[model samples]
Target chain A: MSEVILELDAVVKKFDDNEVLKGISLQLHRHEVVCLIGASGSGKSTLLRCVNLLETIDQGTITLFGQSLNDPRIDPDQVRRHTGMVFQSFNLFPHLSVLENVLVGPVRALKRKRSDVVDEAMHLLERIGLSDRAKEFPERLSGGQQQRVAIARSLAMKPALLLLDEVTSALDPSLVGEVLDLLRDLATSGTTMLIATHEMNFARDVAHQVAYLDGGVLVEQGAPDQLFTNPQHDSTRLFLERVR
Target chain B: MSNITDESVSEERPSFFVPRRKQLLVGRRGIVASTLSVVIFLGGLVAVFYLAPGGAAVRRFYFDRHDMWEAFVGNHNAGLSSVGIGIFTNIWVFLVSEVFILIFGLTIAWTRMSKSPVLLPFRILATIYSDIFRGIPVLLVFFLVGFGLPPLGIAVVSYQSVAVYGCVALTLTYSAYVAEVFRAGIYSVPHGQLLAARSLGLTNATTMRRVILPQAVRTVIPPLLNDFISLQKDTALLSLLGVIEAVNAGTIYQDTKFNSSGLVVASLLFLAMTVPLTRFTDGLIARDRKRRLASS
Candidate 1:
């Protein structure tokens, strides 16, 4: 069996009176791509945020690399260093150039040598086909370009797990294909990623396991073909029906 | 060239040509009307200045009668050898106070925004200082710091000149206002920028200094310049402390010579200094706005 890379047990998160995540449990094994498919405000984003320790859980526990992330003693910053997250808005630092955005994680936070880090960042930018635009700021790039750079920035950290929060939602329809293609490439290359997306086809095609979330509840989860072709839960079936 | 009918040509050209022709016509009419009104207003102002109570003689004396001119334009006593030296003193004080205000004001603003529980007291103190200093008139601060602090037998404050006391007073007063301006700038930065920085594992301090502050300072430049202009004008209030800055020198000349032209000259000089700064700030804001529009 593949060793578990991340585990969440009955994790609950609340914002004021709103209970966003209710007793959510999931496990991600090494080199596994898990896609969380849900409607808007269904707590998919909140769950991913919790895994990254961006949002504090009110109950239960989250363990990353077998260390309890819920424990107050464990620094969130350290956890984030290992777990990369790409947002829906593609929140690249607008002030920094494209190359600097990719370089900052290793150079600034990890205290890596700039000369060593810049080479790696340049390689990442090159792989993403953005080497020529390295000097350009985020605002100067198209939406697809910015999103791709954000993904590259996240990957620059060499994270154990990458969490994508509906990364293609803000992208134009034409732009979505390039980002998805990038994500697919990452998935095939055995990168462990947990994605929250509305794209059913993307989940079915790229995900090893497809989990459906409804109103903070994990409805059902299985291999993508099984879940898409033969959903066990009515909620999952209904969701797939509506999305198709 | 193959099918150049009059109707087709008219159809193609009217969309571009009609608007251009109409705008040209309207612009010509507007310029004529505006120029005529301005000429009429100036003529009326000239007639009033010469014909009204106190007439041309009063205007000439305060503006620049030959006798009053000497008192304003020539050598003067009360520590101002000439009007140039007096204006120079004011400019010197302004530069000194401005440098200190930006540094200390941003520091105080950061203190107000400190999230650490350990800094609760300091935050409270900063907030109180800003509120009280902003409430009290700057002139009162000049009076208190210039006159009040020295008489308590404090050696350090008592030793400085009246000009030094005035600089200290202005710095203390304006730093409070500038701190709030800095705070507003800090707040104006989008929350997403900080979130993105923190999510990248950057410490709060690093995120603030690198990501938040640079953007915030850029966004707040116009407002900061506005506060700076106010600070420039407030330097005149140092006259209350008997500093021989332009306003004080002007007042001394007015008192000894019994002519108001000295004060008028000082006013003109101040306008000459501040108007350019105001225009520069407006140009900066326009460029910033245009850049934003282009990027968006």
Candidate 2:
């Protein structure tokens, strides 16, 4: 039995009058890849933000490793340390070098020794094959290269779970392959991931489980093969048909 | 087929003669007209300087090269030449108050931007300080801090020199203006940058210092330099506090020599300093524009 790393039960979030995520319930287990798929404004990105505590949930609860996140006693920063999120826009610090961006998490947040973190930062950059561009700023990099650095930055924190929100949607179609290949490799290496993405083919190939969301509701969730091909809900079926 | 394609391509070419000739004629006429206007204006001014009935007086008071020299370097009782000491006084007050304004303005800006409930009172105080100081004329602030403080017979302030009083007044007034500049710069940073930093587990203060401020400060440099240029000129206002800076020195020479050449010399000195700084700021703005265009 795999340990549930993250679980949401009836989590609801609203912005002013708009209910972005309504009574959403989902779970992610250790070493598992879960993909959330839906049309624009369907609460896919909002759900990931709520889990990371970027957006506060208006009701229900989020639990990580059996700890309730709704408690005010829990610091959002502390929660974020255990869960890393990569943005759709590849939000690398433009002023900092690639290596410094990676090292900011470990050295500034975690209070690790600079010398120790420098080696780890270089090792992470090496893994992404961006070791040569370590000293270059984000503005100098291509979108694909920058997204890879963003992932390396998150991975440097040694997060227990990673959340990717539309990571490849902003990239050119040609550049998308490199980042998707990187994610495929990360999955094979057993990194736990929760992704909100529009890449149905990528989700079909890489996701252990796929969940369909429609207008702030989770319509259906199951193994990728079952959900993608044999969706039990009409909404999921309509969504799959449209995307295909 | 090749000859037919060539004929079609040649037929599609637009004529370049009529509009090109019109543009050339307009550009040449504009150049000649501006050149003639500049020459006529400059010649008229020179004719007035040399041929008017009061030309001799004008030369003696405002254009006498020797009087200008004497007014700039004429020694006062303090042993240093008037112009020498005047430049020194202006530089000293400008540099000191500049340092204070940078620190005080950025602190006040941060205070106003703070969101914590515990800091609400401080935020209101910062807002009031900026509003009141920026609203009042800087000359009034000089009089108040310079003259008003000493007569109250307060211990440390009462014993301070007139120059120190002027420095304090300028710092207070300009810090208010600069604080608003900094606040605008800080807010100009994209909200997404803050989101990205906070999502990485960095605290609010850490995010501001590391992510936001560096970018904000870069964007504000041109405007900050403009403020400093104004501050450099405002050092003359210190003369009202009996600080004996450039304008005061010029006034002394005008009174003693019964000529305005000293005043003209002082004006020229200020122009000399300000013009280069103005050009430098323009160059910086042009370069920044080019960089933005390239990146976009």
Candidate 3:
């Protein structure tokens, strides 16, 4: 087996009086793709947020490359530097042009020289097929284009792990295909990713491990063919039935 | 298949074109509306101002052309400076105070918004400061800072010039109001922006300076300008502090020449400064709305 890039051991999270994530455990190896499939409010987004340290977990440890990320001595910002996240809404900095959005992380956060990063940033934009729109603001682009720019912005950081939380959930049906296609290419190129998605077919095609979550509990998880063909849990079968 | 074939045969495509002559009718209606507005509103105002019973006496006292030009050029006989020149003092005070207000306001706002345990004490202090300054009237703050501070024998606070006192007072008061505006702008930014910035490993300070503040400042420009317009007018309050600003200069001329036309000239100068800023702010708001509509 490849080296583990992420390990969640019975991680738990809550909000006020509600338990959003109930002792969920998962793991991803380097160059592996893990797709978390769940209904809305099934704690999929919250689980991804925990891995990124955007939300602190209530219990259990999240280990990243053998480092205990939840340790008090660990700086969340330092941990985040090694991981990149793409939100549901593009959330591109409206004041920045498309090229600047991809450049901001390396130049400002990583302290790379702008001249050194400009070529690589342009290459990333070109890969997304948006080099021509480099000078335009995010709002000027279509929803699919903006989301692709967002993905490119994250990729610019060259993070060890990428967390995508329902990236296509907010996109129009016609636009979802473009973003999913980009993700498919990323998966093929062996970028380690933990994606929370609603698309069953995309999950089956791309994910090395498919985890079905129902109401914050990991109902069943396995290779996509096995999980889809024969879910061990009644809830998992029921979910697949309804979604299909 | 049969229904689709029948529908395709009978379907008529919608026309999006409008005739040029029909479009011209909108321009004609606009012209007529403007003409009616001018005739009713502007003409009515002119008649009321010139045909009133006390019109002659009022004109002689307030709108006398000789007094206006004399006041504008300075009452050389009375050894008073021109109201036009005195306006420069108000402008200087406004410009200096605005710089300080913007810096101090953003600092206080950032301090108040910080969630770090290290900033707790500073946050409390900032909150109290804003609360006290915003709760009291600006005039009272002016009196307190202008009349009350200097007598305490503090070296930095003991400025002799009334204009210096005016600048200090204006900065202290307007900074509080502007701080609230900045805070509102910061909050108006969605939480997702903060998350996105943090996920990129940008430190809080860097995120705020590079990402958050640029967006916040853009969102708050119109309201910030509104505050500045109020601040510019309030510079006239410096006249009460014995600063020889435009209004005070006008008062000196009125005392010497026994006519109020000097005050009219001062009022006109103030309107000239403020109206442009007001219109500019309106244009910004309209453009922002149009941009939002277009994008969404």
Candidate 4:
């Protein structure tokens, strides 16, 4: 087996009186793609947020590359350096040009030289087919284009793990294909990714592992084929039926 | 159905359809509205100048051309400076105070927004500073800084020039208001931007500086300009401290010449500065709205 890149041992999270994640455990190995499938408010987003350290977990440990992320001694920022997150809304800095948005992480956070990062940043933009729109701000781009730039911005950091939170949920139906196509390409290239998505077919196609979550509990998880064809839990089967 | 086909054939002539009539910059309705506005404005002026009781006396006292020009040029015999020149003092105080207000306001806002345990005490102090300053009337702050500070016998606080006192007073009072504006701007930026920045491994301070503040400052530009317009006007309040600003110069002329035209000139000077700024701010707000509408 490949090296374990992320390990979640009975993770728990709560907001005030309501628990969002209930002792959920999962694992992802190097160069693996895991798609988290759940209904809204099933704690999928909260789980991703916990792994990114945006929200602190209430119980259990999340080990990233064998480092205990919940340890008090670990700087969250330092841990975040190895992981990149693309948000649902594609929250690109409105004031920055598209190229500058891509360059910001490497040049500003990583302290990489601007000249060194600019070429790579442009190449990333080129790969996203946004090199012509590099000088324009995010507001000028279409929703799909903005989300693609957002992905490119994260890729600029060259993170060990990428966390995508419903990245296509905000795009128009006509625009969803473009973003999903890009994700398909990324999956083919073997970039380690943990994506929380509603696209069941995409999950079935691209993900090596599909974890079905229902009401903050990991109902069942296995290879996509097994999980989709033969869900062990009644709740997982019900969810799949409802979604289909 | 036949007419529809005819319309489609016409549409195929060219993608662009030029209207038969030239588009008028001002329509007939616009012309009528403008004419009505002009009439009402002229009527109001006529009533003020001719119909009101004491119109002649008021005009002689307030709008005497000779006294206005004399006040503007200054009366050397009276040892008083020109109101025009005195306005420069107000401008200088405004410029210096604005620089300090912006710097101090941003610092206070940064201190308030910080989440680190290390900044707790400083954050509390910042909160207290903004609360106390914002609660007090600006004029009271002016009095306290202008008169109270110099008596403290501290070397840095004991400035002899009333203009220096004015600058300090304006900076202290306006910084609190401006700090709140900055805070509002920061909060107006979506939380996702912060998350996105932090996820890139940027520290809190770097995220704020690089990602948050740039966006925040853009959103707050109109409000900031509004505060500045108020600040510019409030510089006239410094005249009470014997700073010889435009209003003080006008009053000096009023006392010696016994005509209020000098005060009129002072008001006109203020209006000249503020009116353009007000319009510019409105233009910015309109442009911002248009841009947002287009993008959304």
Candidate 5:
């Protein structure tokens, strides 16, 4: 088996009186694409947000690439740089252009020369088929195009693990195809991704491991064919039926 | 039983009233109020015109005006030698004063970021400086430096030296105000931006220098321009200290001519320098607001 790139051990997150993550634990191999699926408020997206430290966990531990994400010794900022997140809102800097947004991390975070980062950012933009829109502001682009830019931004960081927090959940139906296609391309390239999404068919097609979740608990997990065709949990069966 | 397209089932006792988009145009009363106000204002304008001294006053006002314009004209008031002297001697001092204010204000504002007990007094001092200077008018500051501070080891100088004192007084009075402006602007930047920059492994200084201050300053360009225009007008108050800036020279002409036209000339001269800046700041504010709206 490939080495584990990430592991969450009995991670628990609570907000006020409500518990969002109830002692969740999981492990993923390097270059694995794990799809997390469930109904609304299932803690799937919150789990992904937790991986990048956007949402803090109240207790337990998370390790990414042998680095303890929950360790006091770990710098959360440094951990954030190695593990990239693509937000549902696509939080591109409004003042920056598309190309500048991609270069923001490399130039500002990595402290690379502007001349150097430009070519790399340009190449990354071309990879996402947005070279022409590089000079354009995000407001000028369609929702799919902005999401593509957000992906390019994540890819620019060259992260070891990618955490996607319902990236296409905000898209219109017509724009979902392009974003999914790009994600499929990323998955095929063996980039490790933990995608928390509501799009069942896309998850089935692109995911290597599909897990069903219910109310902050991982209910069932298996290969896509096994889980969808033969769910062992009654909750999973009922949930799938509702979504269908 | 259907994907929300079952019109036949929907026909069974359901109200499907699509909301018409509401029009938010002002009513007839608002329009009447606006028209009535405009007429009243125009009537006031006509009343002023009737009350104002007629052709003689305007003829007096319009002539010998635009001295800053006439200063560059045929060598009449001062020599070409002195005009170059005026531009270089006085204008460079003005530029220096502006630069000095910008630097000192930035320093004063950033000093509040220090976490020292010694800086506690400085913070209180800076706050008091801003409040006292900003609370009191600019002219009073000039008067203090010109009249009040003179006997206390600070002899007031004349000509260019007087301008320097005026600039210094401007700096003292307005630095505190500008510092407060900078402080308010820096605080206006969202804390998330600083956190994001910090997350990039940037040091506190580098994050502030690279990300926070630049963005914050862009948002505050309008207010900064307002301060600049006010400073330029306050340059006139320097006449109390005997500095022969544009307005001061106009005052000199008024004294010689025994006419109020020089005051009008001075006001127009002040307007000439300030109107473009006012428009430019307005444009900057509008553009920033539009960009923010679009982004949100």
Candidate 6:
């Protein structure tokens, strides 16, 4: 079977008068770790947001797990189930304990039994290495700790594909390393991921492939060795030079 | 030895304050001033009464009074009289009106906060009702409900009915004021609280039920208790339409028979209801203030 699990065909999205995505096309295979590296306002995050229908595309087709996402006939709710996105702000429910926050989307939306959800939540928290902090409120946790809890919250649903929008952007410089390590672990474990990130080293060392974006279009994409080492496109070379 | 110890500083740890003497420090000024004022005022009264031109005539006029006490006790109207006939006429009206006010006020308040377009009309109606009722005097509201409405096919009610309607009118007006208090309490919650609720994938209904209203209602209770207290006193306004609340009862008693002491009795009745309410509200207010201070 072909490894491709997600594909976007000729996607275009505009925000008011400004076009944020300009006819972008890409395919993400199973167990693949892809990083979208670009400067601020370069449409990297918008592209990721479009994948799960967080930001509606003006025109395009998104296919995930052999199913078209957000189709005119398909229920948008179904697409939400297969993909979960973690935001930079680590938007964990503050009034709820970490475990309850993780269990909410599953037990409530997925209609899983409470007992079963609890077991799954513990396992997910353990994977994020914050199993002991499960009963604490989000306010009680550090930024890095909360982000991990957010990851565990999404993981509790056991999504087939995850969207990460600069997950470490809100963390302290010291705390960013620990969350990046967790993301690296998730990638190595063969979880399919599409990350729009600023951590150059993480995008360099861990990404199976890196796509550099500029002016709302994918400028260059290839195996990390080729894209990171030898630049084909002038825009890609200048982007890397600015970052490095 | 006991008698000797009592006289000595060395006795029983030299009791810093001899048991009953503790009162001398805390209440000395109040007791002395109140006692002296009463004595001095009474002394002046006796001098005035004894020295005044019609002193003996005054004594004769006062001492040989009719059997008014017997009339007050034996007459069925007297029970109503002691209640202040005017107040008795309207107390029931006040109570029934207040009940309707609570229901409708809470409804309007909750509606005002709703997102529905239908609720907007209610919100606007509430604003208009509160504005109109609050702007006009209570007497005007009484006239409208009791006298004015009757001419438009509503039956011309008895003073008792008018009084009751008056109470209803007042509560209707004040309940909106009270509802605003509740709305403020609900809105004071931080935004993070709601965002957390939404991201849980909870429907808006469930979010309000589980997380929002409960917390908001906690801050609302103390202020509500205060409004209830004020409502009790405001009920006196019903006397204008002729229900015999305590004040009107005293007025009626004073008018029917010749005695001014009924005024004192009426004051006592109001103080009876208001004092406890004020004390209780003050205690809660104090506790809440302290909590707020400590939190800050």
Alpha-carbon TM-score of each model against the true structure? 0.90, 0.88, 0.92, 0.91, 0.70, 0.62
Kindly give the number of clashing pairs for every candidate. Answer: 0, 0, 0, 0, 0, 16
Q: How high is the CA lDDT of each candidate model?
A: 0.86, 0.89, 0.91, 0.91, 0.75, 0.73
DockQ comparisons of all candidates to the true complex: 0.53, 0.53, 0.54, 0.57, 0.15, 0.11
What is the per-residue lDDT of model 3 for residues A74-152, given as tens digits with 9 covering 90 to 100?
Answer: 9888888889999999899988889999999999899999999999999999999999989887888999999999999
Models, CA RMSD each: 4.2, 4.2, 4.6, 4.7, 9.3, 11.6
Residue A157: error of model 1 in Å? 1.9
Candidate with maximal DockQ: 4
Report the TM-score of candidate 1, chain B only.
Answer: 0.82
By lDDT, rank the candidates, best first.
Answer: 4, 3, 2, 1, 5, 6
Instruction: Residues B192-236, candidate 5: write the lDDT tens digits.
Output: 455445444455666667767877788678788888887776766
Lowest summed lDDT across 10 adjacent residues in model 3 chain A is found at A69-78
How high is the TM-score of chain B in model 2?
A: 0.80
Over the true interface residues, superposed, what is the Cα RMSD of model 2?
3.8
**Which RMSD does model 5 reach against the true structure?**
9.3
**True contacts reproduced, candidate 1:** 0.54
Q: Write the residue-wise lDDT of candidate 6 on B112-147 in tens digits.
A: 777767678777887787677668876677667767
Model 6 per-residue lDDT at A142:
88
**Would you give the TM-score of chain B in model 6?**
0.62
lDDT of 2 by residue, A1-244 (tens): 4999999999899999999988999999999999999999999999999988999999999999888999989999988888999999998988788899999988887888989989999998998889998887788789999999999999999999999999999999999999999999999999999999999999999999999999999999999999987999988999899999
What is residue A3's positional error in candidate 1, in angstroms?
A: 2.5
* CAPRI grade, predicted model 5: incorrect
Q: After superposition, how far is residue A200 of candidate 4 from its true place, in Å?
A: 0.9
lDDT of 1 by residue, B103-210 (tens): 989989999998989999999999999999999998899999999878887778688888788889889998998899889999988887777777788887888888
